[model samples]
Target: MDESTGLTIHKSEAVALTQNGGLAKAIKPLTKEIHLFDTYVAGVSYLKDKTVLQEIKIKDRLTLQREDNKFDDKAIVVLSSDGKKLGYVPEKDNIIFSRLMDAGKLLVAYIIEIKKRSIDYQQISIGIYLVDF
Candidate 1:
């Protein structure tokens, strides 16, 4: 009401603009990444030892450490959970992976499956998962 002018104003009930509800639910967590880079493990002299690949179990976590001090700067050695040397990442993929590791990104590798019958990749197969904070 406007007392000075003796005028009055009326308003209708407020209506919500939303049809169903508020904002949609937060986006689902991203599925873990699984990238298989070419592995140099095939022709490496060390895999020659039948026992080196022994004791490796499926779903076993692996650690990738940069071998900058070694002759191959891009060399990323794969280590078992028990600190055993599994092998080196392929040269083509090692550079990218090395940079990612040096950048302090968290990546986890696990023995996805063991190919006992397959002619290729017969030792074991691995999957790398990205760890998001």
Candidate 2:
């Protein structure tokens, strides 16, 4: 059963339930990802190794962390998978996402497109998704 969309799985598509109930206990809750918005990563020019941007690819997952101490109260810092600082979610776009984070919602970002104009100029577009279980 998919709770988010109220969709039921046909028996043919369902996993068999174990008689011992161990499988039920091991089953994880299903989660649905809702795309909230897409935006470019801000301040990429400030990264130490701009060349690292070339290594990023479409559909790469990124991490978003709230920076409460930042000058902008709504700051959300974006990071690469290996913990590299990849700039921010852009000030104009962080308010709603920051609020959702403050309210304990699970949010994720993924690279949707990467356009490289030169060694010094590149644009990373990411899509933000809300993970609902």
Query: For this target, which candidate reaches the highest TM-score against the unseen true structure?
Result: 2
- TM-score versus the correct structure, for each prediction: 0.58, 0.75
Model 2 quality (TM-score): 0.75
CA deviation > 4 Å runs, candidate 2:
1-29
lDDT of 1: 0.63
Q: In candidate 2, what are the lDDT values of residues 31-121, reduced to their tens digit?
A: 6789999999998988986655866788988989998655788988888887788889999999899999999998889999888867687
Q: Please give the distance, in angstroms, between residue 18's alpha carbon in candidate 2 and its true position after superposition.
A: 13
Clashing residue pairs in candidate 2, if any?
none
Model 1 lDDT tens row, 1-133: 9899898966532223223442222222443455645243323345545454667778788887777645678777777787777777767666777778889976667777766644333555666655654
Give every collision pair in model 1.
none
Worst 10 residues of 2 by lDDT: 11-20
